[model samples]
Target chain A: MRHTKIFVGVGLLLLLAATAWGSDTDGVTQETSFWIGGHLIDTSDYYKKVGEYRSFEEDVWPEFGLTYKSTTPNSRFFFKGHYFDRDEMFGMISTKVSDIFTGKFRYNSFQRQTGQDLLENIEAREWLPSVPKGGGKILTHDITDPDADYNYNRKEILSEFSALLSRENNLRLTVAHRAIIKEGTEQLISNSHCFSCHLESKSAKVEDRTHDFQAGLDTKAGNLDVGYKFGYRHYESTTPTPMAYYEDAKHPVKGTSGAEFGSRLNYDGSSMPIDAKPKIEKTSHKARIKGAAGKGQFASSFALSKATNKLTDLSAKSWAGVFNYAVPISPKTRLVAKASATSITADDPYIDVNTFREGKPSAVDFDYIRYSVLDRTTADFTAQIFHRLNPKTTLSFLAGYNRVAREDYPVAGDGTTSSTIIGQAKVRYRQGMKLTTSFKYRFEKTSDPFVSGKGLFEVPGDALEPVHYGYDAATGDSLWGYFYYMREDLWYQAITTEPTDYHEVNLSSTFRPSAKTTLNLKVKGVIDKNGDLDSLDVKHSKLNGNLSFTFMPDLKWVLSGGVSYRMEKSRGPVAVALFDG
Target chain B: MFPFPAVRGDSTIGEIEHFGSLYTMADYETKAQNVYLSISGSPTAKLRLSSTLMYNKSTGEYDQVNMPDPSIEVSSTLVDQDFTFDDMHEYSNLDYSMIQVSLGLSYKLADGVTFTADGEYADLTDDAGYVYGIESGSLFMVRSGMKFDF
Candidate 1:
């Protein structure tokens, strides 16, 4: 709201000033433009998707623009404002002063419509009439506010300033700030199972904000340029967490055996907050240096950052170092090399869930420490060489290696590591100025790829045989054994869509038969597979093609057309557990 | 084995009779295409016209590959029913297409003055509706205004 007020006030001021000033006075020149218009929108059926990113309300709007330039001290100012509606608008202002200082400010606001899921497809029935719960029921949903419409308003403001601190040393100082705000209401849905397949939805208010600030200073020292930057970001949500009442777990139909059901649930028969957002703060510092080394140019940077969640008092810290160099081996050949390493450490928190079946005879403790997957160390190194075969042809080759080591992941007290080797080759040819073609091929081989630990399907040999239990004499119902024994021995491992081997190819061509006509074509393909999967042959492939043409046969007409197509396929495993017990 | 009536046992008869489930492979495929055309021209020194049309369509589906029958691992009488994996595909399937067209005209009414008008139309078709239902609709918007330069 503050940015909106500022935008309106500035627009009025600029309008008045431009009206009072002459078109040209002395060495000063000014241009001003204003427009007033109204737009109408008509929609049929569901309009949310049609007007997803726009305000569909029919309303009048105004636009204003001003540009002022002065030659005496070399200063220029530009401003533009478009007010479509209360929820949709854009404003921008940029200025240059004395060829030493530059500043820019921008504000934008838009509306987005969100959908509410009814969740009507979750239903189950018991076909056996002799069972305890003999009846069948359909899934039901309740909407607290059925007439409520879900939409959110997003607003963003960005401002940047740069100034020449020292002309002799070519030193510059820059500062920038950005803020984003989202405010609206959305539908919150929660479901409870085991007792009844019931879904409940309630309207929840959402008010979130994020702000970022950065400042940097750079200066030249002999043949090198050095710079340092500091950045801070904060995100907060002021909306109150929505509360839901969980149903007391029991038999779906008979509503008996409450204790058996209650033991399986961590919380029930009480109202608790759901989907609460956590406040976060992050800060980073970076230093970069660039200069000439021998007959080449080199640049290096070091950065460190830390982020914390204020709600939980948990924090993560990361540091990274990078180096890059480019040198010309000969007049027609050049080589570029880059290396980077990053390390991250995050606080591990202990989970304190209620002991499984707390007071029951079959109670078991299930609490454990939580290890973050974000705690990892990564390194990458790449070197590329470019050679010009002739005046019309150029070739480039690249080789790279990447390694990632995750700490206390998948299993506690053990770490998982993955490494990949990458190779690529590219060639470009130009036949005069009429046509240009380029082709690229890339290959990657990964070892010890990341896996999901215990989330995969078990091999037939590793799965424990089903246990048989006698029937219950009172109810005449069959007693079955639990599957935890089988689950504990499951030995197969599954990947999280990470490919162990992959190949990619891309080809593109541009043709300019004449100065007024041009054509472009591109094709890309990729295939990847993970052969180590025990029960699933994981494979993926993608293909894409694009073509475009532009023609300007005369000064009065210009035409352009383009088309693109893409296809992707993947084969993966989906495991479903049997919950008969 | 327990002899007491209603007494819980280490293993349930229901789980032992029906604890048969297997992981199956799913083939997921998606295809998308986009086309756009634009034409702009100045018929006269004081008049300019521009038009653009864009269309996009995408479709995705998931199919179970070599799904095994539950009866193969458990007694036929105990197996509740055969699951049709195809029925679950609708939850993840997608079929959507959208088209947008826009036209703009600008004419110099006088020195340092111009008139501009713009109109746009968009249509969306969601054939494979999921949780949000079918979001098929069409919208048209038109705006006209004047500009001045000094």
Candidate 2:
């Protein structure tokens, strides 16, 4: 309630300013803690994933905590607070003055619970029989509001500042700000098809907000060390925009053609407006540099960004460049390298589904103009090497390459490109602190990967040949070539689960056999394939494992334990489409 | 491909020609398991104790590999029919299991006061129920507190 009275009035004004600054400061230190709690929850079946992120509701709460420290001699202060209810809370503050300036502030609040997809398994049944009169009808749903309950409430705030401009070639200045808020109520589903395979669900209202700001500057200009940053972000969603009424096209049991069902609908006797939430803005710029080359150290960066979409005014722009290097090559070898490049451009919109069957004699004119699969470009490179060979061993090796290019997609005017190559190896061992171990292996290869331009069993077989599109003179009926070419020749091209070859493996171990026992273990594996999917050999696999332990047998007992396992499997190809339209 | 005449007079063949569908292979799976335990202690100098335990289990499924003969005569007057999805894979199966437990205690009366208590329990077992049905649940929580320091 009102954020629990502003967190109990800021925890009683920070406990009366830390008790009057610890009675006239002098290496001050303070602590304030107060708690009076009550919590009780008993659930039988509220199953929202077991109170999705808690608040199982059973109240009566009061908790407050504070800590402060200051050790004069050059000034420095820190503070912390925790007020546990009102959807959890936290606060922090920091300060330093004397060695030039520093500041910090933070706040957080949380709550999340969402689950209400009672779609009832989306039923469907159409017993063939040359479908066309509602053929065996089934599939129906309508839940205008079935005791909906979704939740959301998140808040965050952060602030930071830094200063110290100039002190013999070591200048600095930094600033930051952040804010986020979300309020909720959700659940919206709308469906309509061929006329009556209905389904409808409602209730939607959510407010969202986000803000971010950044500023930076750093110095040192002789051996390098340079920096620059500027960023801004904004997002909005003031709720209110949820409407649905559609459902009026015709023939669902002979309601009559209605312009042949409004010529493959793109809007129908409607109320429109459903699920709308857009308004975003972003801007960024970055530049960085770091020094010392020959013996090691090197860094570089460049970035630019722009994103906008205030209700579809549409915009997107991106740029990136990066490089890094580390060196040493004697007395135990070492080397590292990295490179990156990125580009993106977007802005292409024009759709007018308003002319399809406008005054039909079988009218046709489906306006179009859209192509932007987020126009992309990317490049990456990597190199790594490390060696120790003795003193508790160490070894490493890596190689990488990547490329992607897209301007349209799949085959929109023929635009596509992809490439990938990677290899890796690692090993580590230690016996000093009882034990330590590591092992890794990786490999990847790809070329022409990303697919999905009308996926799923690229249909053909002459799209099931059977031509003859001529009758229907007020019910002579026969008009068939499989409904005008079986959806443009039954999708015959792109499809992918994205992986042309892949392999990975990892192993880890850690053990501390003495001073208060400890142990850990890990394992991972993956396998992927897509051999150009013709008869669909697309495959996927994964496995994971973990084990943990810890024990402290003295100082009054302490123990721990853990175990984990995971498995995943996939195999593609599932095409079943033969619509009787 | 001949066999026409329709408009409700029925001589069959209005659509669906030969094999225009059915091409199975589908198989999707998921599995998960987890276990955890923790314990903390302090035997003297004002009491303290803690405990925790957790368990989880998961499953997901979908299957199909071969299925096609349901009637097929594609010729003399065509007859094709072939469709079966096992109730859409048992309405998209998923099995679940979960368990959690927690406990804590503290004591140190005077000098800056302290005395606290905590408890929690959770359980779930939704064995294959999709689309928010039969969610099986259990939960219990308790808390008591008294702490002061200045």
Candidate 3:
């Protein structure tokens, strides 16, 4: 609501009459379109809730969208909105007055229903069975909807404005507010290795609100570019905590306790006297400058910024500065270098605030507080040479060196400083406009005796293995297809990181013999070993094939399908869970 | 403390996902506060000082506006649900205050030499308990130096 008044004042204050529109006569053009569609899906009960969002695998849903756009030489306005069956909606509008200033607004919202909660309430006679899916009543009407619906909804609004000053200077301002409310279940896990331990959960709607604002200005003076930005953000998050439930399931507040104290499944659905929520405030200030030296041949840029976030008694601060310079040596060679430093300070990090627990000694603590003091600096220098050998063939080489924390102490983590040195070289050859290839190699080593985690150039090939061949092989077929092969041998050893040898190979090929048919197949085998002995950590192979055809391409109608199968074997710790007796 | 409502034997792993689906659609927040004071200045060249102060307080309850009316009295059962951890909840809120001060002093020891001293102090206090239950804190630092030219 405050943002609306601010934008309105900005618009009125900056509403300058257009010089070109006052005398020139131009016709306006507009375009408007609307589409409404619905789908009938054969519901699948297994699609309960997937990927942190309600699944749309079943039921009938309606969707509609409308758009309107007006265009002219100096002014334009655009609007669009889309509504879906799951109580999801999106809308945006923007207008430009005489091309000097522009204003835009956006709003988006969606609701997610925890179906199981509603089902339980209905079966237990706590709610009327007259409820429907896709965002509607859960009980007879709205009687038990508040609890049974167990719905989470979020709505956010954003407004932005921009203006041009002195042709080269520009100013931009943005303000936004978002709200997220959930009345279902929330998970709270202690910061411990016991992930499988009895998970802590609460059934309640914890509300959260966030407000953000930013303003920036950029301009060029003489041969120098200058810019600055300032931002402020605030967040209030209320996490649901375990509490009692009311005896009258229908009445949240005016009901007696259903379960006695210390009894299992005892909940009163009562409001907490004090909720441990995180209230955070953050502010940032930044400035940048870029100028040309050496008669406009050497370009230099610099930026400095500082940001601090305060949440309750904890406070974190970040400061950074960057410098970059580039210049051309001869017509075919160019050199670039960059230097940057970042530092972070925390008054109270995430550590146990209280060392004593009232009754539960083994009970892990979800509350923590700590302090951090860290600083890191990095520098990069690169030299590139590109020469046209003859008329059609060209060659290029790039050499660069990157250093991290080259100087100063690593004040965080184990109270030890670690430094990195990286050197790399790349060569690229291009022949005419048909063939191009490149090869690059890099080497990095840590200076500290104790360091862990992924190293500079180590390939983390766990997620996926990709390989391809037969490109430009010139086969008689419309498209050439080849099997993929990859062999990687790299192992790291350290006291802080996982030391493992990773080797993987895979093959994938796609064949499009005709315009109407397509086929793709891929298979991969992997062998990952860790520790001093090359013991197999994981050995798995997978095969996948997909086939599709344009049954009736001419009429834009087609049907196709595919199937995939895979298996894996591993020697890691046995998959375990916290089981109850 | 036994995981709150549920007893020791409840298999809470799977229920987390099932229950999370009921309400975790989005994240929302609302806040309003005033900056009490933030100033930095020096009355004279010999003495320099700076201090900043801020306060934040929640407006009111957002979701439950129509629950308690003059028509019917609020039942006593509602009051029994006030069970909560000591350091938990922000129902009443806080009148927090954070202040930091820094001072610098310099005096000439000789015609071409001078000694300078600098000190800084900060304090933060809030009303909330648990993780943010920071009652108050103060930090002080002092440094002295001498300059000479010949």
Candidate 4:
């Protein structure tokens, strides 16, 4: 088999070499174009800024991906693949605020709210927190204050696959599949989930997978050319039951009672007090439809293109479209205008991984909630104009507005149908070949009912027990505990965003200091302030610089190095309670 | 603060637990792809079977080392790092390889059930690392089932 493969490889290589040698630059000749490329990414701190216990740690590493393409003027095919593996150990310092959807509680003792403190210090250190008896009772924990030292460490593996195809008439198709599998949580277990001594005796594992596919086609009929595309994406996941020590006389102290306890609870083959379950296998199916219909006119100094687009939801058969036109008005002026309406409807299930890690009741099952299909219709229009002020200077301006009407079917809670209006304006300029700058501002206003799934703050509560009080055998006392269900306010609220703006300026130049090579230097800095109707102060700033030595152009190979520093912060007003106190 | 607390469900609701004497979960075996093979039993043939122990730290809770068997009759504690216990506690052999010597006859029943009786000798060795023991058992598989075309 090895020899057979080698023979095939050599034969193919020879055939390709012969074909290249035999080709002639003659009329009506057949041509084959070959290309290969790939990209590299390194995320040093992913999801690290959130959560008390850091879930993952990392070291600077390298991952290699390869892509190949062979094509004629009208037909082509390609394949690509990538793999990444690593062992990470770190603590989760802060939880992503989004994880509150799982109904997990996280209240600090000293920060308890006015009416929600339910457990004493010693009573608060058990496996699971207690809740009020009534089904509709809403308890809040004080989390207005921040705690910074919490963290948890985890290990993981990530991988991906991709392929592409291009048929006659400029038609193209691409597909990709990606997956991440997490194994070994031993390091994080000590601080997160483990039975004291038994911690050394056990470990936990988790797994996940995703797939994405896309297709694009373009063809010309008479003077009208059309371009269309569609995409699909899906994700699936699973995790087994993770156990800590069961309870016994020698092995006492249940749950995360702090790090000082000598022994953890032992299972001793008894029923688990908490309602622990594995990950709900959630699946998401996504489909997208996009297309452009237009005609193009080419000339020596300028070109113009105009088109109207139509898009539809295949599952629901509801659709809309926009009209767009781009024209080079003169040697120094160019303009583009676009307007369209879009509709969306779909059903997807989301998983709360934090619930599984904390061994709490998960909010991912069908019975917990079935998100009804959503129907939203949005209409927007934009116009952009650019001017070549001089041989070395250029300027561009942009303005746009959007309005959305959203409706939720089978509304479950406080969600409401409302409308929002959003608008933006921007300007960019380039001086000579060294300096480029841009400034933009955006604003939005909406009147809608908001439902915050997780807590922004809360006070801790009591230990969860069956209708009958359950006692810890070793302690010979009932387990009483409480943790705050962190929550943010949700109400019929009117909100606005103003001066959500940003500016970027970059300087670049290339100098041929030597005959053999030219060196290029570039530096850029940007400040971005963007947010939704709930808050207007989400912002970040970044400064970056790069120097490169281009050794070749035809072969397209360059050596470059760059570094970037960024700071991100968000500050919003306190959420006012909706219901009367 | 919100008016009513949201209700949540466990993600692992439909998962099956594998531990103790239970080799499979309810309704799980029905999905297995079934295959059948013919066998002959003879007195002169010799076979040997061996059993080994596997350590899975992540599969079960540490403090409760018994792997959470709600069906188990006794209380269970997590095996210490050394995996030692104060009492006569034992675990099932999840790792096993068998070789047997048989002196019997081959008889295939009309309804696809193959039944044969033969005297066989076998030995099993297990090292839970913390707990070491050597035990043996007979190999007997009575597979009686019907396959439908659909």
Candidate 5:
């Protein structure tokens, strides 16, 4: 293919050179140019295997295509053709319209065919149906064989009409519609050598329409600015397989058909499949904004939007918002921030719910409503300040505080509440280079009534009558006596401070060698001290580095590579749990 | 949750366990490659043509295994003398390939008026016949259409 394109280029260069060198002395020169070009490609078997015991087959048949494009500056057009075992076609046309309102109309047609295979000739080993070995491998279970092949024919005529009212003000509207008629399915017998007696064939019919409207507005937004566009599309497909003689060849076994395999055979057939209607649509809109920002500054911009969905299930909604802000932050600093956010939401009702009980009466009880032991709500606040110390240096500071509380419902008594305070600092240098250091001291205390483990009492039920009767030697003391010796007021005095205190320290650096790339090297150190536990000395540290690179030579292609390394070390107890009853 | 081999009791603490002799496991890994090309041309000064071709191939391996346990505990295995299993083992493989080609034409009558015509054909094949347990099938399709633009 590369060799062919090179040859074509050389031919075109020779033609242009001859035309320039062979010019007569006449003041007027008249010449006509003609050009033709095309390409063809083919590939074969490719495969990949896994797990030492299994194998796979991958193959692509030889297929070829070609195109011819011609142009004469003011006028342009082209002709195209393609060839494959399953399809073949040829067509062409051209036109030019720029001086005034212009339009075009054309007609095209083609035929499409499809075929299926013999299920019996296919193997069914581990599970499913199986064919007899060698000579008698015919399928008998299915009274009507699946489609072996079908053909579809399409014929369409299109026209586009548009007019430019004036040079400064122009409006153009385009509409295109297509019609297709597909033949119905038929039965066909295999070759004499094959055992299969017949196969089913079917066809499909399709109709579609597309529209594009564009309007140019030349107005002054202070100066002259132009903007315009619009689009629409629609499609429909139908398979009118009437309800006259529809019989399900298979029946449900354990569960519903297609849901379970154990009950797949239907001795008394009573099911069938139905055809569905097409539901696809789309719409689009666009606009442009361009003008001057301020003195000595210029600005130009564009905006576009498009959406698609099904009529039956119109649950998806998506949108994009973009803004470009360019202003001076200070006499020596210019700040430019471009931010865009896009979100999409879709709800699918087909999602299965495990709570459903088939064939059971639907009733609501207390068990149907789920409740939480405690309800809680928390609000947080955070802030960061960025300061420029010099042209190549900057400093930043961050502080945050949050308070959370868990209150038991149905009452408004003493509840558990926690509060914390955090602070950090950072410094950064020129492009892709920076040094960051931070220190955090958090004061967290929980306010709740405390009870000592030594002061507790237990009452025995009828099931534990033996223990109450003093038959269990493990608890020699009577319940009344044990309760008398318990201490229940260890925390009754005035409390000086809440309970937990913690501190953390961290330092790191980030570097970028070039645009579309980033690298980072950092070390984090932590020390956690708690007042609630006797041995509360815990420390954790980690050294980590990461590299990322993205290569987009042009908009058409992209390549990306990345890697990361981390080393973690710790010298402290991770967690400890205590339970008392 | 059918016959899940469970034991029920009302006591505060209770436990139940079961063991089986046959073990079944399966795994598969696959990779694929695809390529697409298209071209367009014009036969008449107001007519145009376009063509496209695409090919894709995917290959993978599958493995299945079943074996009796070499370790045992107090729980009894569910294998009986009359219940005989052959421990069937078969190598499974699959190959899928598809190719599509289309030719289209467009005619321009004026600055805002035009006509278009297109024909498309596609074929797909899965080589699953070599294995004892697999399905081998192939598909072929062709379609053509025309549209009026205004």
Candidate 6:
């Protein structure tokens, strides 16, 4: 509620200031302008109704917006704000102080409402038991009595500042900070021994705060351009604690309860721990250098950085470096190269937490792990050449190579490395200045295939052995739900390795048939193969086109239409594992 | 895996296990198509009108990757015949779509003055998802304002 007021107050202040900043400048001899607007709005209801996933929730009762700018010989200021019916708001304020410094502050908040649809679905699940342990069948379902609301809200604020450090105002230092707060609910499910298993959801409150500070210096010293910068960023996040439970209570084994069957009804109400959500924080430091080389005809840059993260008693570190440069071979030709490498090392231990059942902690479950010792290093390189074939045509060629090596404490055996190489070519041509066409072709291949055999590596922890179930008299004609279990000491029972190849083609074109008519088209396709075997072969293709016509040449009146077609064909069926038989 | 303590002297040891292969290579296919048209015109420098028309349709057979099969993922309400596998066919005819329309207008108050009014109307339609026959919220909007400079 406090944050809500702050956001609304800031938004309203910005709007009023932008609309009310008139020409009465108290003899400051400055130029000023202001614009204000208001709107009448209504939604399908007091809340927004979304058609599908990833759709926007449009809502509001009324809205207003305004913008204002004040300028003088030494300084300038500007403000803008917009508030919608849903109470969603946005604000931006910027100012320039003489030739010394410049700064800007921004605030934005978006809202989504889903309680109506969510409740509808929850109430419709009559097949599931209405209340836990109430009976063998569902009779009634309700979560409101337990205090839960399905309203999501997101708000973010960012501020940045930069100061001029030289008389020429070419050297500057900058810093910025941003805070993002998000609240939402997520539905969770489990693939139990049965098809339909756990149906639950958790509502969490999460917030992330990040701060960036950078200082750089740039100057021109006789035919040479040099610049250096150092930046540091620290980020932290507080995530929601998971609260898993049945959306609507259900019979343990879907009716059929007797001594012949499982004797007792052992229901698991919730398993989420009090501190289920880890408090995560990461900080990184980076430095960069850029300069003009080869008599100012080539540009070059280098960078290096490191990062660290801590969660409880575990932590991780990473190091990275980059080098880039570009040079012109001729008036119409240029070559650019870039290279980078990164290495991350982490050492963590396992953890044991108690599992909750029937609204209380029943016993300890050593079936969890925090993290394992992991170290990986990767390097990549790319080279590109651009050439002008003619006054209206251009061509480019690019080649890239990448490799990775890793070791996992849990499965650190043989074949812990992978590598790939790629090559691509592109062409662009303009015909009669009315149509422009571009095409790109790329090929990729993996080398030195990595193979991991199926086996268990001896490690330190708790585990169960591979289990076998069979039916016997007095045991009923049935199979035990437990198929196999890993010994706490070993993981990765089976592994496989292989090489792969990938090829893709892309084409796009734009045409302006007349001053008021335009057309665009694009086609793309990709083929993926696994070595020489038919290991999950895949084919993908897409086609898109757009045509637009403006009745008036001034663009005051316009119309547009677009369509896209996409298809993915996989020869090997990945089979259904979630729901279907 | 169940880790409960058991007294081996039980009368009967009835077991519970899942049936049918988890995944299979089947003839699965999905198809979708969409078409839309839009037009806008300004009769005068101060008045404008625009509207949009859209239609979308999707169908699937033996395939429901996007059909909101919340069954296997959430509850068992969508299935009619328990685990008889007959319930799987409930999703065979996974087809749904809608025709949406939006109309908007804007008008200026006077010449040389930066003042305008804006409004829009949207027609809410029903859905075929689990929330069957439930119509989305309709929307109406209008706004007016002016600008000044000195």
Which number leads on lDDT? 1
Better of 2 and 6 by TM-score: 6
DockQ each candidate and list the results: 0.48, 0.22, 0.01, 0.01, 0.04, 0.26
Candidate numbers sorted by lDDT from highest down: 1, 2, 6, 3, 5, 4
* Tens-digit lDDT string for candidate 2 (A1-581): 34334533553454344334434456655556666666666777765676677765665555556666654655566777777677767887776666676667677877887877788778766555556454544568788889988888787877676778889987888877677777878888877654666878888888787777788999989999999999988888877788888788776655677667667788777888877888899999999999998789989999999989888889899999999898988889888999999999888788877564456343456676787887888999989899999999999999999998887885555778889999999999999989999999998999988888774543423424544545678988656433432445556646788998999999999999888989999999999888887767788999999998999999898999999999999888766654333
TM-score of each: 0.90, 0.32, 0.48, 0.36, 0.36, 0.69
> Over the true interface residues, superposed, what is the Cα RMSD of model 4?
29.6
The per-model lDDT (C-alpha) reads 0.79, 0.75, 0.42, 0.32, 0.36, 0.52
Fold similarity of candidate 4's chain A to the true chain A, as a TM-score: 0.42
Runs in model 5 with CA error above 4 Å? A1-93, A99-143, A151-163, A169-226, A241-275, A290-315, A321-340, A345-581, B1-58, B62-150
Cα RMSD, model 5: 20.0
User: Which residue runs does candidate 1 get wrong by more than 4 Å?
Assistant: A1-26, A59-73, A129-140, A458-491, A578-581, B1-17, B63-66, B71-78, B84-91
- In candidate 1, the second chain superimposes onto the true chain B with a TM-score of 0.82
Q: Model 2: C-alpha RMSD to truth? A: 28.0
Q: Which order, best to worst by TM-score? A: 1, 6, 3, 4, 5, 2
Question: How displaced is residue A411 in candidate 4, in Å?
Answer: 8.2
lDDT of 6 by residue, A343-377 (tens): 87675556544332222122223445535434778
**How does model 6 fare in lDDT?**
0.52
Is candidate 3 or 6 superior in TM-score?
6
Across A1-581, the per-residue lDDT of candidate 1 in tens digits comes to 46435544554454334333322344766677777666777788888887788776744455433433333236666777888878888887776666577777788999998877755454456444355554643366787787777899998988777778899889999887788999998899887665776788889998998888899999999899999999999898888778888889786766877766676677678788888788999999999999999999999999999999999999999999999999999999999999999999999998877665456334567777888888899999999999999999999999999999988787765788999999999999999889999999999999888887765654332234444444557997675443343445654555678999999999999999899999999999999998777657899999999999999989899999999999999988866544232
